[model samples]
Target: MACAWEESTKIRDVLIRPGTENDCNTIMDLIRELASFQGYPYAPQITAEILRRDGFGDNQQASFQTLLAVDRTTDKIIGYAVFFPFYSTWRGKGMFLEDLYVKPAHRKLGIGKLLLAHVSKRTLDSGGCQLRLSVLKTNPAKMFYSSLGFDNLTVDDGWETGRLDTNALEHLLESSGLTRS
Candidate 1:
């Protein structure tokens, strides 16, 4: 597969920027491409409408923030990264990089590295203590993450990550009659 372009067909002044309302579509396209590459493409039921509502809707409080690497001339996005804040209980506040995807066709042109540096810089700017991410144990991404200075959190496989959703928490609160008067 051809790697990243040294110079695009015409889009040379590529820019990496924070996601904006105008980029919602481009971001979704990248997300789909990444998911497809990972072999899970979107679930059978999801749609573009759901993506906008869940991810870009006002008042949405999802943990992740998205960034884009775009080619200015052709206006084609080459890659993206998404990350979020996390609490370490002991390590205190940190960042969890939830997704980092560089289209295979655009790999190795420093886009991935630049995207990571962008994340690390933002983490420090936000007062985060450290940056962390999880990768499939068998995936080659561990190498990329390690090169970026992420120490593999070698916790004994005994402790697995936990997840909870707003709806679940709401149910618990209602069942306990803990709503504020």
Candidate 2:
């Protein structure tokens, strides 16, 4: 099985280091490619320019916390995980794993698990109360996350996720109707 193969290859020692500005392009490509694998395909609207500006930008709306895994032999970036901290009213502070992707060829090598372990350790190191993440209902990666000991927090009633499109966003802004003096 591909999953088994990915896991086995990942078992080998790999370094999980923090991502830097130099890694922006590679991370962007990986993000785009990984998104395509999950069915979406296109140049990421999040450009290298944007990555450099916002992620490492001047004012720093927020900071990007990423872990990059490098393959020893080829010295190529094989996997990455990005996460950030969040405030949980119910649980105080918690960390969110925003993205985790490992190249197919370098998978089964324990990269995914190691990536998770790295995040878990970082989360604990930061004095966070919990590690939280979201998964698409159709995403099979849920199995891998669950296998990593992350339990689902299901609400009793139906709690569905929702999002607003560009049109709706414009409508909301217009309705609120901010005007210059």
Candidate 3:
């Protein structure tokens, strides 16, 4: 839960583990940090309540999974990844990695790689054949991902990305003419 610290080569004792309901607040904080780093200080609106309700609710309606990397010495969660399953018409079941971030000070310590490896394994174990994520054009992590053999959809596969923000989403829904009975 704090900003990245100074970078060093010293040994970093870190542990990657499944995120629990108790971690919702910390996870949300880390997500805010990530948004600020990505040049969208006010982009993330997720709250701990939403996280707990959606991810750990009794109704079993969660849509995503989270894994956190904690610094063993400090017991602080310095990194995390959020992902979920999706169906692809061409590839069948797939996993979509929504976010992958490591504290600036915690970068280059192989924590990101370990997190990604865990997600990849989880995807395979869940009978998924594809893993997808979106990276910002200005982000330097693109190189790291490239080194890991991830293809750039735009360059490698000629795929373009699109999205609908909250306003557009509301407009679309209103225009769709669908309503509850």
Candidate 4:
């Protein structure tokens, strides 16, 4: 899909489309940009190689989907959104929006909203009702999401999010002493 926006009274066109393997490098760059913007400049461990293998390898059972917004004038990607499906024990199925980012120069032009709307449609198309994402308490995007009717799980439903990294997960499994038959 394409959107036309007037930024600074200058009309610009942007195209949003499904990402391909050829976009791995650009996707990684955007991921890094997002990490930096979120105050974790070094948090992104993804490389083009990893992205290719996990997202677009020959297996074709990719774990995620990415949508890119390319500026029509320059034909350069200015924004992207990454998402995947996950099962919620209560809801049965849901969508996790891993990242939604627009270049600093492209904000306020509805790119983020367009990406979000697309993902919401994808979620509904897949029979999902919940779309989950995490926002830092200090991040101003929290207010934007609230304005869009996204409720804070902790405050609204007392839901606590948890995570385990590779090392911690390995340690937990070792301590559990479980073995395959």
Across 1-181, the per-residue lDDT of candidate 4 in tens digits comes to: 2344245232237788999999999999999999999899999977899998998989779989999988888999999999999898877888999999999998877778878988999999999998999888888788878988997988888988888897887787888996435
Which digits, one per residue and each the tens of the lDDT, describe model 1 over residues 79-133? 8988888888887887888788888877756778778888888998988889877
Name the lDDT value of residue 100 in candidate 2: 92
**Which prediction has more favorable TM-score, 2 or 4?**
4
Name the lDDT value of residue 178 in candidate 4: 62
Clashes of 1: 0
Tell me the spans in candidate 4 whose CA falls farther than 4 Å from its real position: 1-12, 179-181
Cα deviation of 118, candidate 3, in Å: 0.7
Model 2 RMSD, rounded to 1 decimal: 3.7
Ranking by TM-score: 4, 3, 2, 1
Top-TM-score candidate index: 4
| Residue pairs whose backbone atoms clash in candidate 3 | none
lDDT of 2 by residue, 2-115 (tens): 887765665665778888878989999899978887787774688877877767766756566889998877778888988999788878887998889998887656778888
Q: What ranking of all candidate models by lDDT puts the best one first?
A: 3, 4, 2, 1
| Model 2 ranges with Cα > 4 A deviation | 1-12, 154-157, 179-181
TM-score of decoy 3: 0.87
Error of 2 at 92 (Å): 0.9
How much is the lDDT of residue 36 in candidate 1? 73
